[model samples]
Target: MPGSEAIRELVAACVGKVGGPLVALRKIVSAHGHIDDEHVGIVADVFNLSLADVRGIVSFYSDFRTTPRGRRHIRICQAEACQAVGSRRLTREVAEALGVELGATSEDLGVSLEAVYCLGLCASGPCATVDERVVVRVTREELLR
Candidate 1:
């Protein structure tokens, strides 16, 4: 876990420069595997930041995680526009069929399910996600098969 001291130092340096401090932290989280007890301590200690400041950054971003996340993060739009096109029905069946809850990943690492407010593809509606990619006009069969 500590093999990359040089990388750690590089991270420490770059972290303070990018936009606000919070944005820097988010960059690190995206590059690294997961943020947990170790990251919380190391990031704070290396950057000479406070624990409250670090945790505060995490709380602000929906993308940030205190625990671990699946290798892939998936999102399904539940916007009114999407619902009008049957995204609600699609989301329910996809979650059940995949055996994963909203905001949770399947144990097998296939996908993670999340409800998104909108994807700006209202014309397509019925939006879904695979990893970071947004899939529009998705069907239950499309979500599962």
Candidate 2:
């Protein structure tokens, strides 16, 4: 975790900028992996917002995480197109194989499983992402490897 001074400096740099609070939060996440309570306080103070306001922003955005993700993150598409192509079955199988439920990280923090609404590969439905790399027509066998 960065020292409070460091966090304040980071947040201060975003002052007078557009969407300062959101930008500051993103910067903090980029530097520290996730935003914690201390970060939320610093951001709120620097941006002249309430703690609830900053917390609300963090909670509202799926991209923002209050905790660090695992080393390998897997996002299985659950959109209409992907579901039509057996993504539901694939999701269940992958979750079982990984030993982690959706929206959860493994005990060893080596892997995380999450549900994504879409990956824009509708034509190739049943898509998933392994550490940010999109895998089309994904299968349980392919994901385990």
Candidate 3:
């Protein structure tokens, strides 16, 4: 976590004259990987919002992770379309292989596994996005690779 002073400076730069809390959050996340309490407080102060309000925003959005992610991030589709194609089993295999549950990061921070509602690849059910690259018809062996 960065010091309060550093967070204030970063917040000042990200928060424009026009309101863009979502965009500012993205910028902060991109720069720091995650938004800690200090970051949230800084943002709330800059935006003139309460701490709880800022926390609510963070919790409402799936993209805003409160904790740090691993070097590699993995998001598997878990919606009806993906589930129909055996995404459940694939998710299990991935969790086992990585030794971490969904929404958790590996001990060594090698990977962060998360379940997304959809990747907009219904045709390619059981799809996954690894580091922002979409992979269709993902299999356990392929993911392990």
Ranking by lDDT: 2, 3, 1
Worst 10 residues of 3 by lDDT: 14-23
Q: Which of 1 and 2 is ahead in TM-score?
A: 2
Tens-digit lDDT track of model 1 for 73-116: 66889889999988888888888888898878677766778888
On TM-score, the stronger of 1 and 3 is: 3
Off by over 4 Å in 2: none
Measured by lDDT, the strongest candidate is 2
Cand. 3 Cα-lDDT: 0.86
| Per-model TM values vs. the true structure | 0.79, 0.91, 0.92
lDDT of 3 by residue, 45-137 (tens): 888889999899899999999988988889889999999999999999899988989999998999999999988889888899889889999
User: Considering every candidate listed, which one attains the maximal TM-score?
Assistant: 3
What local distance difference test score does each model get?
0.72, 0.90, 0.86
TM-score for candidate 3: 0.92
